[model samples]
Target chain A: MTEPMFRTPLRRVRGLGAARSGTGHFWHQRVTSVAGVLLTVALIVIVISLLGRSHAAAVQILGSPLIAILMLLFIINTAYHMWLGMQEIILDYVHEDKWKFLALMSNTFFVSVVGLASAFAILKLSFGV
Target chain B: MADYEARTSSGARRPRPISPHLQIYRPMLTMVMSIVHRITGSALYFGMLLLAWWLIAAASGPNAYANVEWFMGSLIGQLILFGYTWALLHHMLGGIRHLVWDTLHGFDPADREWMTVATLVGSIGLTVALWVVGYLAMGGPR
Candidate 1:
């Protein structure tokens, strides 16, 4: 067989080890985290504005397309970012092998449920359904 | 390195130290604050369910929404809301701390401590100020 072109001697010899996904996960965590901060601030402002208001008043405010979109965005970012952060926490602390695996799975599941529920609620309100 | 390989292959029993953690190190301010940061981050997870519930209730109907709104105005509900507010503020400050670190600042011992203190104080101050403004916006407490 012909030798592969542009292969370093090391590649031809020892070769590369595992291509870890750690870097992608790290960058994603940071990007989502930054988005989360902005969305969270927007949400806090919305909630504070709604405080002491009647249900109709609050709903009217949220029904506005801008607020509804922002709320949905906030929920999505928070759910994903929270999942990533919780996954790191569980990985670091949950030393028990079985429990660690279970906790990791639960983290994803919980965030998914929360995301779906919140997104559906936002859509329902936005569409007046 | 060679000896490490040999030890592993030989299957000789060796004493291994337990993980370095809270017991090994003296508690420091940053240590306590860092743990609190994680706690607040986690708290936001559960606390946010309240927001979800409110939205769902609102989408359901005006009457259903009012049920949640009324409860939120109750004394106990207010307390929980207050705590949730603090948690949000605190966690936000912690996030800022992380962002600052990301920019390659605050790695110095003194600066890190100062930022830690600022995170705590700033969150409390901001929460109180926001609440004050919120109450004022509503034309003062009823």
Candidate 2:
């Protein structure tokens, strides 16, 4: 089959190429992987700092602006990276078309839920709400 | 055909011939590491859920946060936390390994073997060292 072209601007902005060979997914995954590595270190610091501390103290630590922001970034990137990683796994393993589509949808939903849930918690704590 | 994705997209359906699975190929250290990399990545999914719960529990107020904290302090929780710690470190090393490959070097057999061993050793060493520091930080309570 020949490659499909999108004359529409909306589809073009989405990075779908003529051969569907866009680098967006690869780029996102790599960028987030690097970010996840750095953020993971920052996360270990926060956890270690929280160790043996009270609930109030832990909350106070997490609610700090810097920790909250870093944690949010870590959570968001990790979830998205996970979605990309799992998508590749499902594509490689799930051969049947029906199951593949279903699995893909579930992957998207699951990642979004995890990301959103983490973001909400972080934002709430950061705002001291 | 190697273009199985394209063929299937065109609505002609057949039992898509898959490339050789691990069964057909003799498992080497590097090959095993590749599969281990994938498994570690998947392991982080559940680990992420645990993290999310911890964060939410912290935000939810004192008692809720205390309950989650206590569970994490329990025996099974400690074991899971230990595994999570190791998995995170292992996966991070795996990511670094890939990043090195992205530079277009490290494809030689020796380099590949060296990296697989490095990742395994580095992750295990880091996890153990971190736990030791953690224990000491707790004033030798354990």
Which ten residues in a row are the worst by lDDT in model 2 chain B? Answer: B1-10
**Model 2, runs deviating above 4 Å:** A1-21, B1-21
Q: Mind giving the per-residue lDDT tens digits that candidate 1 earns over A7-113? A: 66765334333544536667788898789888988997998898778777887898889999999889888888888889989987898788999999999888888
lDDT of 2 by residue, B55-110 (tens): 88888988888888789989999999999999999999999999999999899999
Candidate 1 runs further than 4 Å off: A1-19, B1-15
lDDT of 2 at A51: 83
DockQ of each: 0.39, 0.47
lDDT of each residue in A1-129, candidate 2, tens digit only? 744675556666576786475777788889999998899999998888888888888878888899888988888888889998999899888988889999999999988988898889888888875
lDDT of 1 at A21: 52
Estimate the overall C-alpha local distance difference test score of candidate 2: 0.87
- In angstroms, what RMSD does candidate 1 have relative to the true structure? 5.5
> A37, model 2: CA deviation in Å?
1.2
Task: Enumerate residue pairs that collide in model 1.
Answer: none
Q: Which is the leading candidate under DockQ? A: 2
